[model samples]
Every structure is written in structure tokens, then in C-alpha cells.
Target: METSGAPQTRGARLHHPELSTLVHTSRFHAGRQPGATAVICEDRRLTYADLHHRSNRFAHALTAAGLAEGDRVAYLGKESEHYYEALFACAKTGTVLVPVNWRLTAPEVAHILQDSGTRLLLLEDAFTPTVEGMATEPPETVVRLGSLATWSSRYDDTEPEFEATPDTPVAQLYTSGTTGLPKGVVLAHRTFFAIRDRMAAAGVDWIDWRAGDIALIGIPGFHVGGLWWATQNFNAGTTVVAMRAFAARQAVDLIRDLGITTACVVPAMLRMMLTEPGVGAEDFTTLRKIVYGGSPISEALLEESLTVVDCDFAQIYGLTETGNTAVCLPPAAHVPGSPLMQAAGRPYPGVRVKTIDARGRELPPGEVGEVCLHTPARMVEYWGLPDRTAETLVDGWIHTGDAGHLDEDGYLFLRDRIKDAILVAGENVYPAEIENTLESHPQVAEAVVVGAPDERWGEYVHAFVVPVSGPPPTARDLHAFLVPRLASFKLPARYELVDAVPRNPSGKILRRELRDRFWSGAARNVN
Candidate 1:
């Protein structure tokens, strides 16, 4: 209904259809282009027709198992053809898909399931032990990937009856919480379609898509990078080649062997790919476009990737709440001398971005402030947190809690998080959890964790600790103790023994002072 841009308007429609619109699109494309490949998983290949039929079967199976339209289904598995089928099946049945991060601990997985009120879970057999040991029993329907035959037989007799409306919830993505626990961000079909349409209008060209075009998706499907890119390409009738897990050599091999033309990866992943042995010119010849995001890519890494991949590189910026990419630095802007490359690029079509001060007053161009957004692509709300939702969304703008400035040229430059959260390797590391864990140590009196610039990862977690009774625990000791308590990525990388943490008169840790050390020579405060 909203018409903010041209290409978006062409894709937009007045009717609110069900989430199954994706399935319908797949079927329509298949019927029109039956021979077109829709997915490629290692040795397996599936046409659009194959995907449609399989997803229908999967949807029917889900319905017969007593799963209804509003039920939450958690997917805890790696990227594969099956993952796509499950996602489309959920969309077809109007069930919400909640993809669990494979890196999380058993407890973290259980927490997500319970928090999201998931009734059914679809998992790969490899993770059977992990799921079986969870504290709470998810819904009785636990379908393992390898045993689909047994599960599918249980529901084959039931008739397929599924209809999804545009208002139906499509996904509930959980974000790393800064205060307490992670919160599920509820997103509807309209939000997804709006973002997809906006992205297509801004730069994506589906016409370039062809039967032979192969997309290598190296990032985990649990993350937005892999999930959205795969979906968009699949809808366009392109073959998507997924890697179960990210390995630099494996990715290069896929490009060389599979003739993959496009791929999505983070800067860290790109760095690792360049470091792989035998990584050379020919390994990258098949690649035409390499999309990198999730964190700022240093000029050095960007240049290195250009040399290794021989492809146009594009940068995207957004969070889970913004429906993947709200701002994109197009591939043409990757010119070595282009000043725009230093910015996060312009806002995606139909996405309006503005900088606002603490009082919510709009700031003039080039002035740093909280970055807020107005877009139909924005999440409906943070699930079960009305007060938090109100705090974030006001007057149709979603306060990003990110500090940035928009230049006169309309390029966005990020400074820091308005909420003072830390980003390490593109993963959010909240200081509250680290400080709480450190303070729990009997030998420590007080603790503060902050982000420090690192060449490898965008930032690394640094902890400042004050001894209580005996000598403060060593860095190794603290890391060992925290590894089991928190996600590995959330653990502090460096430990600084200090008499006291720098704090304000009101007793708030001065994270700015800690950040200054690493960013002293950088043009921007952000690493």
C-alpha cells in the first residue's frame, strides 16, 4: 500500500496475502519456467517445481501433526535444501519460523524455545543429543531431517489446507539483548515483502538471474545474510548452493567447481577466505558479485578481497530489527578512491533514515546522533515487551540506538551504539552480561567490559577488573570460567587489571575513555 519508490511500487500490491506468497511465487515461476533450477545443495539439484512440491508435502505434514497457523516452529539446523523447504513450509502454513543459532549452547537453545513459546522443532540428526537434553520439552512434534520418511508417513493421509494472509507472522528473530535476555522480534509477511521490494528497487536485478546462475551462501541460515539472500534468489528462480558451515577453502572450492556467480559473506569471512591455502586468481573467476556486511570492512580487507576475488564488492548495513539490509553500498561504489565507499552508502529504496539527538530532535546533516528509520520493512514489535517496543518505535520511526551521521551527499557514517553495546566480529556483546559474570567472581570487586578496535575482527571485548581480596584472576582463568557461562563470542578477549574502572560521579563506567585507546588514530571513533 505504501509507495515510496518506483521498483518497489511495481512489486507492491494492495491485497494482504498470506506468508505463503513465497510458495505461490515459486510455483508460478516453476509452472512458467519448469526447467529453471531453484536450489543446489552440494550433490543435489532441485528445480522450482521440485521445491514447490516438496514444500507442499512438508506443509501438509506439519498441518497433520496438529500444528496450526500461529504456532511457532523452531528450526535448529545448518543451511541445506531441507532448510529452505522447512522455511517455505512454515510460510505456507502461516506458522512462524524461528531459526536458532547453531553456535548457542543447549541452555541458550532451550531459552529461545521457551521464550518464543515454540511448540514444534525441526532439527538435523547431528544435533539430536543437544535437543534431547533441553530443559523443557518443546512440542511433542520433533521431526528430524534424516528421518523425514517416518514423520511424513504420519501425516500423508491428511489433506493439505493452508492459506496465509499478509498480516500473518512469518518470523520471530531473536536479537542479543543488552539488558536481560534476548527478545524475539516479530515480523510479518508485509515486512518481508516490503524489504524485498525495496531492496530490488534500490539495486537488485532479478533479470540478471538465469537458470545457470549459482549463488553460494556461506553464512549460516540462522543469520539474515544467508537467509534473506537465499530466499530472494530462490524466488527469482536461481540455483542456491549452501555450505553447511563456513570454511574458507570450501567456499572457494564451490566457486571453482560449481561456477557460482554470487555469494554473501561478512568481512571476517572474507578475510578468512583470503587466508586459505592455494587461494588464487582462478578460484575467484566464477564470482561476479560478493556482498559483505554485518560489520565495517576495513579498507585493507576490502582491498584484499578485491584482489583475491576479482569481483565487485558491495556493503550492506542493518540489523535484525530492520529486516536485513536497510542501507546498501552498491558494488559500483567499491572504487578504491571513491569517498562514498567509506560511508555505509545510501538508504535502501523506501527506507527513510534520519539522525536525531537524545531529545529526539532531528539533527542537521553531518551531525552525529541516534540513527532512526521509517520503513514498512521494520519489525512489527519486540515480542512480549510493549514498553521496550514503545521506547524504540515512536512517530513511525524505529530508533536504531545506533550513533551515526548522514552527510550532505546522503551517505551514512556510523560512530557508535547509542546504547553503548559492543560489537565484536559483528556479534553484539552486551557489557551487562560480562560485568555481571565478572562481578560474580569472589576475588573480584568490580568489572567493566568495553569494545576495543581490532584489525582482525572489527572489535574485541576488553574487561577491566578490580581485585576484591586476593590477586585478580588471570585473563586465561577468567576466559575459562566464562566460556561455559556465556556464548563463546561474548567472552572478553583481553583483560586489564586496574585499581578502579573509570566512572562518572554518578557511578557509570566511562566506556568512551576505554574506547579512546584503540581508536586514537582512526578517522572515526568506531573501529
Candidate 2:
């Protein structure tokens, strides 16, 4: 990471020990660096003062609309200053902000809105039709992105009259569950700042944010990866350049034009940007470090990134439930032809990682089993799903549904997912969610979904279907049927007609049996 120059007087003290939550940071930064740019999205720019006052005004508007502490306020839109305004607004009022992926189908969007018990939805103008179609039961209040400024202009810009602590819930991000539905992962303010504090205490500089750093956030704010990265920059009082939606060409231009010093992106994004025309070392001169994760990086891609982008590359590994990243492979380990390239980085300070057997017994190093993480960054619980929360979080340790082992050096080597979830371009695609939708079709008697290796997307969804009787449904027919029911990424890229889905005596469908066919020669179970 690029080191900071002489620290600005009042701005340097914005990181006071008392500024533990968003409420504190927002207020502190506004007073310290009112004119400093906090966020940049296309034509919109929010200075530290603008972010604080606008969020405060919106917080009053939320209260005026009868949203009290702990109420859920949802945002269905792409990355923008508005999303962060709503995020900080929610934080100031003790309300939880739920950021929905804008790419999801109407039904998928409806599920998140209803499941979260959302009181108000702050929507983008583009999704008005999608929300209108959800006539079933939508949120009580809906505010369009276009009118947010005018609506909040009537309220006072002063800080809201509410108390917020480090443990207050701020964000409730939904992650696709293995049971065919998405569950809300409730995160406290501490979750956003825990790893930073840990790193400072441990004197670790693996992922440090410096002043004057222009950080590019290519990932949308909906995902934890995006949210965490953005907040980390915000907490450090750095300028954030957020993309409305990731396009390879735009990303390349943004880095060169905006002079982005650091970036956090998935490996797929980096790959796409490299393929853009005229992309060369000149496009990355200002970039000092690039942190990538969401899925494993291929050796070829890693080598190419090092040679072409020619920047320090750090790899992070974690789930949404872990508040983004618990493990980070620092820039020092990005050497080509090294075995460390295949390993997920070591856990952050104050984070504990171990492999556990099916019986919940911790295994020794080099033994692959279910990976578990105990970190202060872990989520509070799976919102409103006590039983599900119990199943995952045991004794403060999250039983990550991943199969991995730690080397003697403490680097994690992920073998496969213990849960049958597919990582397509960075979004989690659960097979059960697709299977449930597929089985709803008249021609599909039974359906199974599995992740197939893909060169660009890391993994693609593949479906094996058993017809009810007579002629089987063609792949084209199935694709059309699923277009409006599931997100585009969740749709199967390939389909096969099967006579029967293999099952155990207990009637459990053998997903592994079908999945193994496509992964026979792969070095790892996941792409």
C-alpha cells in the first residue's frame, strides 16, 4: 500500500479512540475534514461534511416516517453516494440497513423485502417497475432515489437525537443459504472496524489504509465484500470511488483517470479489465496494491496480473457471515511459481481458524475438514433464524461450510465447499434455490444443480433434470422458464436429461454423485 505523506492536522486526529461506530466517525470526520471528499460516484461527490449532514437529514426523515431503533431499512439499487447515505443514516438511528442486489429477479427481491420485515425501502428510479410488480406485500414506505435530496432537504442537517454504540447493529446483508433461501447476516458497527483495530494492535500492515488514498470500489455495495471495503476506506478517511455497476472498460479508465492508489475486486473483475482494449502497465501506474477474493485465483491469472498490472496483490478469503475478510494473503506472498499462491492467506490478528471433522472435533494442521473461524468480525447471528444461527455459530466459532486445511505456516488451503453452493463471478448461487424453482416446472419431475468449472466466471451452474414422463424439456425451454424466476447468474449454463437423480436409502439426493462427474480431473473441488 502507498504510504501517507505529512498527515493533515485535524484530519489525522479523526481516528480518535472514542470514534468506535459510524455515528462517531461520521461526526468526527465532518468536524475535522468537512471539505475533504468522502465518496465519488459518477457525477456525484460527497465531502465528509456533505456525507455527515445528508445522512443526518435522512436519519430525521427516517424517524419522521416512524422507523425506530432496530427497524429494517432496505436499499435496492447499485453503488452510489445515496446507498452510503442510507447506510450511515441507518447507523445513526440504530436502524439496520439492508442492501439488496439490484440484479435479482422480482421474486428474489420480494423475498428479501418481506423476510427482513423492512419498514421502508429506498429505491433507485430504475427499479420502480420491479417494486411495483411486487403487489403482494412490499415495505410500508418507498422513497425514490430521485426525490431523496428534496425529501431530506426539509429536515435538519444536525445530528439525529439517538445513541449508537460499537455493538449496535448497522447492516443486515443477506447471504444465500443452503436451504434454498437467503438469510440476513446481522452485523454490528464493531464488525466493520474489528479487523482494523486488531491489525493496529498486532502492528500488522497487511492491509492498511493511508491518507490521500483514492480507493476504487468496483464491487457493488450490496455484497459484504463491497460494503466492507468501502467502509474500511471511509473509516480511514480516504476518498472512495464507487462504480455504479462494474464494467471492465469503465474500471480500466477509472483507475488511470482517477489515479486510484488501491482497489478491491474479485479475480473475475481483474481478468475482465485485462481483456479490455489498450489496457497496459500505463493504466495502473498510480495503483500501489490490489486486493482480490470472492473466489480463488488461477495460477495463470495471478502470474498475468503480477506481470501486467504490476502491483502488489493481496488475496482475501471469507464469507458474508465473517463480515467480509478474516484471512488475507498479503502482497509479500504473491510470488509466481510459489505454493503460497494456492493458499488462502493467513487469518488476521485476533482471528482464529481451524478445521473441524463432521463430529465437530478440531483437526490438526494439514488435515482437511470443515473450516471454522472465530473472529470479532463474525456476524451477530442469522437474523430471525435462531435454529439456523445455532447450526452455524457454535461457541463463538462460525462453522464455515468450507473444507480446507492449514499448512504448518498457518496459510489456509481451501479444498472444496462442504456446502453445495456455487460461486458465480462472486455471487453465491445455492443449488437448492435453483432446484426448488426448477422442480416447480410441470415437465421436470426432479432437478439437481451443481457448479461446473468455468474459465471466466470461476463456476457456472449446471443442471441435471429428470422428466416426469414422455418427451423431456429442452435446455432452451428450461432457460426461458427460469429467466424471470431466478437471477441471471443462477440460471444453468448447461443442462442434461437424466433418467433419475441418484439417491441414498434415506432418500437424500446424491448431489456429490452428480457433481463429481464434472470435477473429475480438477485439482480442487471448486474452480
Candidate 3:
């Protein structure tokens, strides 16, 4: 498959089978590479043969325990090798796996479990306290994950027969709820495989993975970043080193001790790792590639990362609906002063990107507007939300609410999210552009721009900043730095210093929270 340039056809569909049945591919490779390590956890290492056989046992156990095909089973726990076993066990039995984020509060986790109508909840022992006292709709069974003794003794010897067809729903991922309550994004085997194939065809060399190559999966499996990468690694016959939870020191230690070559992380994780003491070029000697996404990274941090980490950096740009990455900035573009480093790079081989205005008219290059993406990897629909599905997926294009522009070279430059845009005196101001300018200041460590309610202008830009490792800059000093970098209308009217900004697990700023502070007493949520 070609990994560069445009796709040959407009309506090209993926050739991979249903995702629930996709486990068979890994199982087949498992027998051929029985001794090859498939997963390495804190204190456990499972070879390909072990993983395949154990997941088979898990499948039989689920069936014996009354889990039928298409039954929803939610896995609520932290990242571990057992998480993969639980995930594959669902696929092997044709059950839909719903991985609930452990970072969420018990109430939030309960809401997801309830919404999915899960028949079983598989949890880790470490998180038992969090779920034990929570009021939730009781599933048919509550099994503790990672119990080898129980799993080995429980199920029948007969091999269970199952196949995951393209139409079979493999997983239901809930939205990150950046704006409001989370909604389930239902994906099938076809969608998952399409994304993997699309990514491989877009310059990602998955086939180059050797049986001995160790891949680090630090991100939680609940997010697309963790789930998709793990699946891809498994398919490529590579071993995965699972981190139970993300810790800067742990990540560094894993790389050094486990000989981790490839890893996927968000910008926030990278920042945290860089802040750790004793972290330097020598720490990441075995590391080959670091794929980063979820939010825009500051240019300063991006540059510093290249100097600090001894590995190639690839930036990806996509949403959950678009199978995680529809655009990729390859390793070569990570060059500090390169123009491609500023843009999000061109669209993936199988994806088509366009800019459009409010009326849906296509905007010319260099025109800032909503980013519209067309790809085979686009999600089929939002589960139970037909109206929202229609509103978002139109004319074969997913209307990404993100506002950006494509340069003449087809490089994408994100301005701001449409919902985050501040309307002041009838002029549109993108907070990202202003925040990016502000973050470039020598005294600014981090900056979040939000729209504050104004009696006269309707809404004005409000800046919240975190100072660098020096004397804090006053509001006036920040304004002076931003004045020349941005337009007069875009300049923030109110400036406040914050120790830290509220960010989601994906590192996206919670603009709604910033807006909520100014409109606390008001009826409506937005300014």
C-alpha cells in the first residue's frame, strides 16, 4: 500500500475484516512466533503463545459465565497487560469491549457503565475501593481481572468458535466531554481496520516491526491513543510494555530497562517527562519514535523536546471520529526551524481535507474556516444520537468543529476550535492563535485564552498564564509582549496568573471551565 500522496479512488473501502474477529490475525502470528514476547507488564511477561492461549481461556470463561455474542462488557481499570487480555477476550467472543477511563470519578465511571448497559464489569484489584462503594446498576457478574489461578481452572477445554465480521461492533468509546456530557462513539471491525490500514498507507511503517521490537504503551487503554496503538502493535507481531499508570519517572525507567523503541504519548506526558530530574539525552537511548497528539504543542516545547529526547518525533492530528489521526507530521518535519513543523502536515493518504465556511462553501487555501475531513476511517455514527451523527457527518465529510486553514503546500495550521472562538465587537478571534503568541513569551510557561462576558463588546479575550522559571510577568508586561504579535482586537482585555490550567487526559484545555468562572452567576453556561 502506498504511504504517500493522495488515495487512488474516492470510495475505497478497507479490506480488513471486522475488528471483533481481528484477533485471529494476531492469534495466527502467535503460533508462528510462540516464544516471542507479546506483552510485558510490571511483574509479568506473556509470550505470543501465552497471550493467545490465555485469551482463549478467558473467552471460554466469559461464555461459561453467560456472556453471549454482542454482549456489552465494560473493563474499568488502569493500564496493564491484563487490560489487553480482557480486550482481546471480548473480541475473541464477539462481545463489545467498553473500557472506562480510570481517571474519571466513580460517578462518571458509573454513568458510562450504565449507559452502555454492560452485562459484566471486569476491574483491577487496585481500583476495587473506588468501585466497591459506588452506587451502580449491578452487572450480571463482577470479575476481578489478572487472576491467573482462577482463569486457569475455570473454563472448559473445548475451543470456542467465533468470528468478528466487518459489521460486528467491537468497541464503544465515550467522548472526552470537552464541552458537555460524554456520548458513546460506536465503532465496528470495519472502522478499526480501516484506520489501521489508512495509517499504514500514510507513511507509518507497521510492517517493519520485528518480533523482538518492544513498544511502550503508557497511555490508558480507554483513549483511542492507547487502544489503537496496542492493537496495531499486536497485529505487527511486536511486544508491548504496558504501564499501569503514567508517571514521568516510570516512563523513563521503562525506556531504559525494557529497551522500549516506539511509544505513543500526548504533549502533556512529554512535558512531564522533561520536567523529571536526571532526565537527559541518555535516558532515551533505545527510543526510536515518539508519536504525539491530542492537542497543539507549543513551538518552544516542541523545539526543546527535540534537543532533550534522543528519538524521532511525529505529530498526529485527528479526532476520535476520524480514527485518531487523519493528518500526520512525519519525523523529518520535527526540525526546529522547518516550516512543516508549524503546520500539521498534509492529510493522510486515504483522507481528504478541506476548509469550509458556515454555509458549507469550500474556502480557498490560506482561508481560515472549519476543517472538513473525508476518510474511510471516519466513524459509522454516534451511538443513539442520529441527529448529531447527521449534523457532524455530511456529504461523506466529517465536519470537524476545529477551525483551521490549509496553506498552498497543503500543510494544515490550526487556529482555534469553533466553539472556543471569541466573538468581540462582531470580530472573530481564535484563542489558539493568541495563546500560541502568548506562550512564545520568554516569561510565559503556559497560557490559556478564553472569552469573558462583556456588557459592551459581548465577549472579550481573557488570558490565564503560568509563569516560566523566573520572576512572574505582570498583566501589563504580557500585554506588551502580545501587542506586536497579535491584532489589537485579539489582545486580551483581562489577564490573570494561574499556577496551572485545567486540562483533560488528552491535554486539551478546558475552555468551558475558564468561561464558567466569568459567568458563574449567569444562567447560561457560555459567555
Candidate 4:
């Protein structure tokens, strides 16, 4: 959870105070509070001074390896002190840090590596097999994270001379590829500071991180929520206690034992913790506020959570392209039976949101249209995908594929996702990616994927397949085919043999129609 970097005037300051760029963020806090603990991971604790020196040495190590400004460095591991080190080190040296999700299969992992054109790959020892199995050429400077300590110790503890600007790409977070292949969302140093600075200027006390704030980092670092949330905790001079892997019981224990004052988690994690045995209101007495996003929380889960927890609940809505959260549902808005709880909340101080029709004209309130937004924290561009960048970011407004309507009071109510995506436990699962694997089977002719109503997970992957003019393929046969190509979570939870897949005139699969057939009599479009 520790982030930020060395003493280096490597950039010009933006509008934000003191620390405008990522490089300055480190020097400002470390100089002010050197002895303060920055991170807590199991038995390891890193102070601000340690964070500065270790990141300084790591910056030199990366420089010695010939990774200069704008070079891409990728990390394939879970959340760790090492992950944050690489993030800040890259921030200081002006290199782009790409954290790939370790949950991806060899092929999906290979695509990100090849697409990003990574120069240095910082990998965990456990992921060696995945990297080795990839057909693509691996990055030249591959350093196993298990030995990262020994590697960085050889370098100098001083900062380098590479100048990074406020607009310099600090990180490239890959979206889950809801539309097609995932595009790298390029975030600058200024992207991290924008929202906080705006909130301070406007005197919005929605998510102020106090000095004594101890944040529990629960989400995976590969996602924007995890990485950006940790960095913000550091920027505010708060300590971050990160969990390597999320378990319901352990999370409750960490809050009880470690006194986690603030936490950023998805709705799924909260749902599990509410049902975890022995968890009660007393366990979370120290928690002041929790910022949750990625998916809308069910009313049932919210009611159960509030029953056992007496803390401020803030709901956030954003994508990887937006840096983190652009809109937030403040604690006061979470009433038990109100329309506000169903809405995605209002925008931050400097962020502006508007719904637009296909013609790009702004739609009036209550009219369902595409959610478009403009914020200081918007991504620079989709890396190497100029066409996609143009399509998504038009005239500085990002067209979020989500179909939602803004109320008179400006709360965004999400109706449906325009993109063919399945929100499975807060993870985006594109049917195209799954269909590609299912159709690869010899016994399958055509395939269509959709999300079905799920109890534990919000929506689980379900596939409909048309068989080749022979015996119908068994679920086991299709499962075996996808085992190697897809990750365990991406695998279809249910399969239905169909005569033919439903498609429109232009050969586009009508996934919503297919979903409706199975989701009949359901209270809502559950996904």
C-alpha cells in the first residue's frame, strides 16, 4: 500500500499545492514526516524515510537497466510493498508502470505484455510459469520480485536527473476489455492529485484522509481502484495496511485487530464480510468511513452491512479511464429506502457529468443516454490505440458505455450497460473474449455469452452454444476446451446447447434478448 518517491525536483508543479507531480509527492511528505509508517504488510512496516530511500535506489536500478523516461515497466503480482515501490520508482524516473492482473491466463497476460511494449517486467516467482508459457517475446529486464531487495540494494540511494512533468504518464492501468482487447489507460501524475485538491478547494469533506487514518487496502493492485487508493493514502500522510489476498474472515479480523479507520473495497467484499461468522458491530468500531465502488450494492447487502457496522458509507462510480472515482455517493445519501441509494451519486468539485444520445447532443434529465464525463483525472489516452482513444475521448469528454440517466438533483441512475459485458463480482467479463474460446471447440459452431442472475456474485457468466451437425457437446467437453484459454473466473458457470445463436441482421449477437429469456420474472436486469 506504500507509494510515492524520492527527493527530486524532477517536474514543474501543476495547480495542486506542494506536490503537483508524483515525484514531488514523495519528497514533500517524506521531508515533513520521515518517521511515520507508510505501509503495513503482514510483519513488514515501511516508514516514509524508508519509502523515499528504497524508491530512490529502485529508480537508480531501473535507470541502470536503461529504462529511461516514457519506457514501460510491467508488474505481474498481487498487492505488495514491492508493487508500490515500482509504481513510485517509475513515477520518479518518468517511466510508465503497468501492473498486470495475476489472475489472467497465459494468453491474456501475453496480450497486455505485447500490447504495452513493456521494456522491464517485475514479476513474482509464482507467475514464472505463466510468463514462460507465453509465445510472445518477454521483456528484456525481467526481475523476479522475490529478489527485488537484493537487486535494488546494489544501486545508489540518491535520485536521478530524468525530468518528469505533471502530465507525464505515471501509470497505465489496463481496463478489463469490455469492448474488445483491453486498452492501456494512461494516467499522469496530475491525475492522482486533481480530485483531492478540488475537494479541498471546495471544502467538500466527503473523503478527507486525516493524519491518524489507517487505510486497509483490500482490492487488487492491478486495478485502478487498488493502486490509486493506496497512492492517495500516502499523499495524505496516512498509513496503509494492505491484504495480499482478500478473505471475508481475515478482513474482519484485520479491522478488529489493526484498527483500520478507513477502507476502499468493492460491494462484493462487504457482502462477504456481513455474512462472515462472528462479525458484529463491535468489531468495526474504529472504522470511520468506507469508499465502495465497481458495482452497485444490492439493498439487501446494504441493509445487512449497516446493521453490523456503524460507519460512514460512501459509494463511488468510475472506471479505469477516469483514474479512480469521478462521482461519489456521500454518507448522508445512503438512506434505507430512498432513490439516492439507487443512484450513482453526484460528481466531485471539478468533475462534470452529462448524458448524451447517439447524436452527441446532451440529453435532458430522466432521459436514458450514455454517461459522458470530463474531469481533470481523465486518462491521457488509450496506449497505442488512437482510434479507440478518439472514439472514447471526444473533445475531452469520455463516453462511458454505461447507460444511465441523471435526475433533476444530478444523481446518476445506472439503467444498463451499453457494452456487452458481464459484471461478475465487480470484474468485467466480455462475452467476446469468452465466445472466442467457446467457438474454438470443434464441436461448437457458434456461441453467445450473457450474464445470468447470481446470488453470491452479482452476475455469473453463462454461455449459449450452437453445436455442429452431430452429437451435442457435453458441458465437460466445452469446459475442457476453455480451461487452458480462459481464467477460472472467466470460465462460463453455465452452458446451454441451442439450435442456433440469436443474431440481428448485421450479425451482431443480441445478448440482452438472450439474457431476458433466462432472466424472466426477475425483479430487475440484475446485471
| Candidate with best TM-score | 3
Pairwise TM-score winner, candidates 2 and 3: 3
- Count of backbone collisions within predicted model 3: 3
| Model 4 per-residue lDDT at 77 | 86
Tell me the TM-score of each prediction against the true structure. Answer: 0.76, 0.80, 0.91, 0.79
The positional error of residue 247 in candidate 2, measured at the CA in angstroms, is: 0.5
- Cα lDDT, all candidates: 0.73, 0.86, 0.78, 0.82
Q: For residues 1-527, could you state the per-residue lDDT of candidate 2 as single tens digits?
A: 22232246432322344457988879878887889999999988899999999999999999999999999999998788999999999998999999998877788789889889999999998988788787567788999988999988999999987978888999999885424678999999998889988887677778877667899998778789999999888888889999999999999999999989899998768878986788888999999889898866656567888999877888999988998999999999988879898789999999999999889898999887899999998999998999999999999999888888899999998865767878899977767567767876778766788998899999999999989778889999999999998999999999999898876321246678788888998899887
Model 3 stretches astray by more than 4 angstroms: 1-21, 146-152, 156-159, 199-211, 504-508, 520-527
lDDT of 1 by residue, 1-527 (tens): 43221122322321222223565565565565667678877688887777777777788888877888888989988777888877878888888899887766677788889888888888887777777788877667788887765666544422246666666778888875434677888877666567666554455531133335688887777776677777667655567888888888888888898888888888768867786877888788978778778765555557667766787777888877777778878777778757675678778778889999878799999887899888777788888889988998887788888888899978898766666667778876767567767766666666777888878888888888887666668888888888887898888888988898665321235677777777788897556
Deviation from native of the Cα of residue 7 in model 2, angstroms = 4.3
lDDT, residue 423, candidate 4: 82
Give the poorly placed runs of model 1, Cα more than 4 Å off.
1-20, 153-160, 199-211, 421-527
Q: What C-alpha lDDT does candidate 2 achieve relative to the native structure?
A: 0.86
Candidate 4 lDDT over residue span 436-504, tens digit each: 567657687677788888888989988999897789899998988889978888899989999876653
Q: Write the per-residue lDDT of candidate 3 for residues 319-347, one digit (tens) a residue.
A: 77876778878787778888777787677
- Candidate 3: TM-score? 0.91
How many Å off is the CA of 22 in candidate 1?
1.2
